[model samples]
Target: MAFFTGKVALVTGGSSGIGRATAVAFARQGAKVVVASRRVAEGEETIGLVKAAGSEGFFIKTDVTNEADIKTMVEKTITAYDRLDYACNSAGMEQQPTPITEQTEETFDQIVNINFKGIWLSMKHQISQMLQNGGGAIVNISSAAAIRPIPGIHLYNASKEAVLGLTKSVALDYAKSGIRVNAICPGGVKTEMFERFTKDNPQAADAIIQMHPMGRVGESEEIADGVVWLCSDQASFVTGQILAIDGGFILQ
Candidate 1:
C-alpha cells in the first residue's frame, strides 16, 4: 500500500466511472491524486472519495479537447505535488450506433477531438513533465472495440486503435528516458458509457454481456486495477504493451 507513499497520480475524465475508480485506487495506495474532468460536481466528488481513501487530492475542471486546458492541468498538478509520477488519460466519449450515412461532420469532430486529439495533446504536455521528473508511467484507456469492432461506432474504434499506435510510438521515444507508455483495452465495463450504450440499444445490453466468456460485464474498478498496475513499479519492464481487461470479449 505504501508503494506510492509519496508519489502523485493524474487521472483525466475522473468525474465518474473508470476514471473515478482509478483515482481512488491510486489514493488507496498512498499516492496523492489529481482528478480532472469538465464536470465540476462529479470531479469534486471524486476528490472526496480520494480523501476518504486516506490520501489527499483536488479536482480540476478541464476539457481535454483544449490544448490550453491540457497544459494547465499538468501545470496545476505539478504546482500541488511538485512532480508527477503516473498518469492515466481516460477522458473519451462513445458514439451511439449510427450508420455512416447518418453520421455528420459534427459527430466525427466531437468524437475524434475528445478521443484522439485529446489524448495526443495530453501526452504531449504530460511527457514533457514526466521527462523533467526523470521518469514516469502513463496509461491510456483504449477499447476492445479497437480489435473487435461493434459494427456501428467506427469512429470510436478508429480513435482507440490510434491510441495503440500512439502508445507504442511514445513508449519508444521515451524508452531510454525512464518513461513508459501503454494502453488498456477494456471490454464492456459497467461504466456510464456502457449504460448509455445499452440504453440506446436496449437489445445490445444482453448481447454485449454474452460476448464476454466471463458470463458478465466487468466493473470499472476491475479496469482500475489494470491502470494502477501499469503505473506501478511492478510493471517497470512493461511498456508499449496493450493490456486487455476485457473478460474475453475479443476472444470471439
Candidate 2:
C-alpha cells in the first residue's frame, strides 16, 4: 500500500521553493493535499502539480501572518477532507539584508510576524484539527540560521530560532496525544529566496556555498525528501528534533 494512502495534508507557503516541493511529495505518496499561499496563481500551479501526481489537491489563499487567513485555511481543509493527517508550516519571508545596528523596527517586525508568529498560528489551528482526529504529524521549515547565525540577517536568524523552540514545545505537549512535531533546517537551498539573496550580495552567495562542505547548494527536492520522511510512518518514533539538510554546512 502507498505510505500515505487516503491521508490528508496541508502545506502553507506551497506556492514555491521548499513548500511547493514538499506539497508535491505528499501528494505523490497518495495524500490529498491543500496548498495554501497568498499567491493565488502560484498556489493553483502547485495544486495542478499535485493533481498530475495522481492525488486530489486544492488551493487556498492564505497569509500566514494573518490569524483570520490561517483560520480559514484550517476550516477549508477540514471541510474538504474531514481530517488533517499532516501539516507543514513552511510559509515565511526573508527581507533585504541589514546589519543588526541598522535594522529598522518595521523590518524586524515583518520578519518576526511571518517566520515566528505564522508558525504559532498555524500550530494553534492545525493541532486542534489533529486532536479531533486523534493524531497527526507536523513539520516546520526552519533554517540552518536557527543554529548558526548569518552575520547580516539577524532578524531572520532569530525568527528561525523561535521556530525551533516552537517545534519542540508542540512535540512535547502533544506527544502523548499521538501527534508528532519536528523541524527541518535547510541551508543554502537553490530557491527564489536564495536567488534573491545572492542577487543582492554576490559575495555572500559564494561564501555560502564554500561554507557547505559538500561544495554545492542543496536542492528544494532534497529538503522536501527530509520533510516527507519526517511526516511518514518511517519517522514514527522521532519528535522534537531539528534535522539539518544543509549539505554539511553546519559541520564546517
Candidate 3:
C-alpha cells in the first residue's frame, strides 16, 4: 500500500510551481488533497492535476496573509476530510532585488506578512486542527536566501530566516502534542516566481543558475519530492529540520 494511503494533505499556494507539485505528489501517493491559494483559477487547475494523479481534492480561495481566510481554509478542509493529516504552507511572494537603503517599510511588511507571518498563521490554525487528530506533519516553504545572503531582497531573506527560527521553536512547543513542524529551503527553482525575478536580466538568471554546484537550477518536482519525503513515515523522527533541497546552491 502507498505510505500516504488514507491520509489527507492540505497545501497552501496550490496555484503553481512547488505548491502545485507537492499537492499532486501527495495525490499520486494515495492521499486526498485540499489545495488553497489566492489565485482561484490556477488553484482550480491544481485540483485538476490532483485528480489526474488518480486522487481527489478541492480548492479554496485563500489569502494566507489574511487570518480569516486561512482559518476558513482549514475549517473547510476538516468539513470535507473529517481529519487533517498533513499541511504544506507554500503560498508566498518575492521582493524585487533592491538594496536595504532603498527597501521601504511597505516592502518589508509585504515580505514578512506572507513569507513569515503567513507561515505562523497557517501553523496557528493547522496545529489546532491537528491536535484533534493526535498527530500530523507540516512543511513550510522557505528559501535558500534565508541563510545564504545574495545581494538585494534582504526582506525576503530575513523573512525566510525568521521562518526557520519560528519552525524550530514551534517544533519544540508541539513536540509532545503530536504535531511535527518543519521547513524547506529550496535553491533557485524554475518557476513563475523565478522567471519574474529574472525576466529583465536573463544573464543574471543564467549566472545564478551556474552558481549551483549541480550546474543548474532545480525543478519544482525535485523540491516536491523532498516535501513528500519529509511528511512520510520515513521522516517520523524528523522535525524542526531546515531541509535544504537546493541543487547544492549553498555549497558555494
In candidate 2, position 217 carries an lDDT of 94
Estimate the TM-score for candidate 2.
Answer: 0.98
lDDT of each: 0.94, 0.93, 0.92
lDDT for 122 (candidate 1): 91
Q: What's the CA RMSD for each of the models?
A: 0.8, 1.0, 0.8
Q: Point out the worst 10-residue segment of candidate 1 by lDDT.
A: 194-203
User: Candidate 1 or 2, higher TM-score?
Assistant: 1
Q: Candidate 1 vs candidate 3: which has greater lDDT?
A: 1
After best superposition, candidate 1 residue 197: deviation in angstroms? 1.1
- Taking the tens digit of each residue's C-alpha lDDT, what string does model 2 give over 147-233? 987788889999999999999988999999999999999999999998988886879889889989999899999999998999999
Residue 88 Cα positional deviation in candidate 2, in Å, after optimal superposition: 0.7
Instruction: Give the per-residue lDDT of model 3 (tens digit) for 72-184.
Output: 99999999989999999998888888978888988888889989889999999999999999999999999998878677888888898999999999999998987888999
Error (Å) of candidate 2 at residue 151 is 0.4
Collision pairs in model 2 = none
Per-model tally of clashing residue pairs:
0, 0, 0
